[model samples]
Target: MKIGREDFEAFINGEKSITPYIETDLLAGSYSVFGVKTASNPNYLIKAIYEMYELNLNKKLAVKAVRNLFRSVGLGSVGLNNLLKKLGIDLKPSEFLMLVFKLQHQQGWGAPFELLEATDKRIILRTKQTFESQVMKDWNMQVCGIHQGWIEGVLMAVTGMNWFCLERTCHAKGDEFCEFVADQAESSWKFKAEAIVKGESAITEFIEHKPVEGTIKLIDDPVVIMPRFVFTSMMNSLKKTMGEMPAGGVNYRAYMDMGKENVEHYRKMGITKPHILADMAFTFYSQMGWFRIISMEWNEAKKEKTITLEHTVESEAFGNTGKNVCYCTAGLLAGIVEGSFGIKVQGREIRCRSKGDEHCVFAITNKPE
Candidate 1:
């Protein structure tokens, strides 16, 4: 059966007024046929699951499976463990089936972060700081005020890393920012602040930004707000739908310290200036030469900025950070900074660095509008 766009929209929007059976139909359409049971014989078990549960199982159920028994009743609303306790089922199949039910019934599925793509070198940052930090609050303003894209990046990185809403015990002066009250998704990650000052310069220092000669600007200044909005939406969606990772999964402190220390080391080694740093790092990693600004194409209508130049780079340096980990650290740094700042920094080529020298100076500056 063909599902109309409006019906799909209503289903996704959670308009409880609609018929619940349709949800089951939607799930059956998307996930009913998995292991190939054609006209000869259909997967009755799977069919029972759809008919009994009457829940949408597209991305959610595809991620996991659910049992017909528990979902048939109202037990589906409770936690997997709680539901198991209520049902008094110890079988492995029972537990697995419950997980499947949870996945199918889950309101939203899929990692919101996956939707994020690199545009004009925009990046998503993952930071380690209390969202309430007066410094970070101010830093956020600095980023969003100048570049709107960074707002979403900051929100996602901050909340995804579990630094959104801070508690009273959080160490921000004046309590200027409130703890993050649950947003629509009821996330625990939260913090409040009126301003974003330059955060612990040590960690945030890794963010690098470059000016492209040609920027596609929107006629009504829409591009200016695109990146930040995108980041914000993604983070909010994750907070609401995707719960937190395990306790020890993401060590924000470690990532922050490592990023800071690396940047400081680069600075000490004389990657002090932003322009120079960008030049040298790109050259060393991409093995490309830089020339002074020759020309720029700024597309205000599209909010895209492009810089044109010529240089040589090594192919190996641009490979992934696993086996060909030439510029892993540098590449990661570039991604973090670009994502956080919502800027683009690309290389035309790559080059091998001298022995005992695995670093280069990158120049970054916050150009005040």
Candidate 2:
């Protein structure tokens, strides 16, 4: 099953029929391991991982675990090896590293990266932005362990060699850039020190390095995003931690923030106004396989409107939590309303399929005047 640009784009656009197992196979190379859809908000995905890191209390162990998991998956059937093979590039060591960077960019991780140096014994790369760093910008921590592991995993899969990846500097640690060093040596501290000195001595050296020759151009294909299950599971984990307190409140606030960010993001793209933004939001969610929008209406006279969305996959899968568990969706809708109208509005999930309702429904209304 060769995944071409058209196929990839179709999959991202929800024009391709995807079963849970197949999607998992395509992305993570295991069959139904996640048992959910692929494609998700990167921020949500990183947050879930960060939460896990905090829960474990041992950042090293958490990072090691993540690396091992990613490595194992990358070594599996239909994984990174297969992806590289499909690209059909006869790449040198440096070119291969550049190819990896290109693949990462194509996957929508939202960062521009460069291969500063690559040799048989060592490789250095730098990025101004990274998904984890961008997501954890406010936190005082280094969150590049997963990425370090990912690089190691891919290298191992590609070269059949044990390579160690270390994050010498991180944006989360207040550095101007995130720097990664990979080598096959047992001692990585020396490489880390070198990277630090090099980064300081001539930062522009890395930035000004000419692009590698014969770079493989990545196809503008759709990325296989994560599924709703990933976010839902993370929410459920938080709920478990909250115990007696209602978890919906946390989800509401978090998702409302996300929605507001989405609005700001779209606004920069020249998408403003309630109706147009709502339609754009609906299209985005629907394309990501969240649910079908049955109806969306705006009542200017009553300062109220309603959106009826049905067949929400999250609600259908979790099945009757005895309360409206779609708080995030509600918050998102409310955020869209607020962003669109430039006024405060409230959104409520009046009916949820998870609560044994036939459809999940949301109501939006302006605040009391």
Candidate 3:
């Protein structure tokens, strides 16, 4: 696992391939996750989710589960394997890692993921402003569990060795830069993205069909793409943090404004017709992987919008929680309607997968005074 002296010489002699092995679809306003298009959410929002899970689960258990959940993110970068093989030159393991980390930086995972040091027993990696750490700077502990797991999975992929990746320091923990250390492992790993939470199963996957249908739209918004699990993990974390409130109240209230703020960009485009506005909103929503709409009813005279979604991610995240938990999504729809239709509306999740309903239903009607 050590970067041999010859490897260092190869790297220093300018024989390294600087070409990145990742592809980001900037025109489509998204990043490709194993060829599946994904949208971005605010980093602080995702940070809060990590805190929520930290609040609920024991530290060790949470770390272990998360490491497993994000393993796929690293393992899916098979492109790097091809890049290395095509070089057709003998390079040391450390050189390969250095190039791969540089590719991660190019792909926007960090400003620059640099190889700090390499020894017979360990390899040290460093980055100052990792997206994960930057968002969690208010905390007293490291928060790049995703990156740690990424290292573990990618190291295994490159070297065909089980490497245990650990965060030695983090910006969230008052460190100058987030640092990760990797050492060979004795095979204590599992591919369990659907780790359980409070006796319920977390969602294992979204977009059952690989390589989601149609080309990702060449939209006009800038995005930061990570694995789909990060979003699901955020929702699952919300369920844990809700604690005593009626299942969905906390989630519903905290994120209601998100939709309203989001719709403003579309609203300013001068699309006045309510149905057109709704269509615009739903297209953005669907592309973000929230749900696949089964039906949409926009009542003009009544000023109500009823939407039924078959693949509700919120319900899937909490698996059989025995009560309606798409309240956050309902609040989102309500806000979207208020902004899109110019009406004050009462929104409700009338059906939810958690309650064993086949389709999740949200009814947005005019709010009574």
Candidate 4:
């Protein structure tokens, strides 16, 4: 089906699913299966993986997740290879590499990644404006794991060879451009591959090397935000359809499950401290414009904590209905407390701005023995 701006808008509005819009046809080898657009915001994609990274604290797992995401994309690239075969473009190793570069640039992955050197055993590639570098500059770590996996996946799919892509330089590490080297030699690559598969930080070896200094203009990407009204409407609609059950039971269960998932995520990301986890949670929500954590107090002795969140737009938008309306927020807070503190805690929205209070207040207390 032909995708248009309306379809994209509908997708954003939660009125349509993206699956039907994905075009399987090779539109002039442009990877325009999603259609010809100048550029697309990757904030949602970045945020999802970043959240997973924060939750698991496992760099390798996060990297592997991104790699797997692209590996699925690489499966589609295999289909593209079949299309090229029919078009009389021979899938020579060099030609396939060029095809990868072309599709990468055409899809606006970077300002056109260039093949610096290619040999029988190794290949070198460079890009001045990689998507990961632009989006993850603040991360201060090599965030090109997706690209590494992607290159390996596509190459492997085409050549049927086990490939290893090492990111030698990353813009996230303050490099001017990103550089990657793909080696076909299994012996040289096996150690890092094994380490990554074992969920260990194999990226340390790549980042330890000095990066070359160069000058390149960075892309000024726009921040994307979900409309406040849309979010409120969705929440209100759920409340209306599900009735009191949603606020009292469903919301808690759903977000608590989300919390459990986040706990696993943060564990993988290697963050165990309650204070750090709480701070990270506040920052994560604040970045998404959920609410500002006005104050937080943790009592290690009592194993209890209180967090004051203010300017909750959700409550403000819906207004005071004479009941605690921030059920989802309350549930999320409960989950965070449980995950971070490693204890059963209940979050109660005792005060709400919707009910003529100064701000939404949540009291998190440990479950009694």
* Whole-model lDDT per candidate: 0.28, 0.62, 0.64, 0.64
Candidate 4: segments with Cα more than 4 A from true spot: 1-41, 185-369
lDDT of 3 by residue, 100-215 (tens): 55545544553366788886457888888577777766656777777787777777776777777778888878889888999985641111111221212122212232235433
Clashes of 3: 0
Question: Judged by lDDT, which candidate is best?
Answer: 4
A best-first ranking of the candidates according to their TM-score comes to 4, 3, 2, 1
lDDT of 4 at 222: 22
TM-score of 3: 0.41
Stretches of candidate 1 above 4 Å error?
A: 1-180, 186-369
Error of 1 at 241 (Å): 50
List residue ranges in candidate 2 displaced over 4 A: 1-224
TM-scores vs. true structure, each candidate? 0.16, 0.39, 0.41, 0.42
Clashes within 3 Å, all models in order: 61, 7, 0, 11
Candidate 3, residue 201: CA error in Å?
17
Task: Quote model 1's TM-score.
Answer: 0.16
Ordered by lDDT, highest first, the candidates read 4, 3, 2, 1
- Clash pairs detected, candidate 3: none
User: Looking at candidate 3, what is the lDDT of residue 305?
Assistant: 74
lDDT for model 3:
0.64
Q: What 10-residue stretch in candidate 4 is worst by lDDT?
A: 214-223
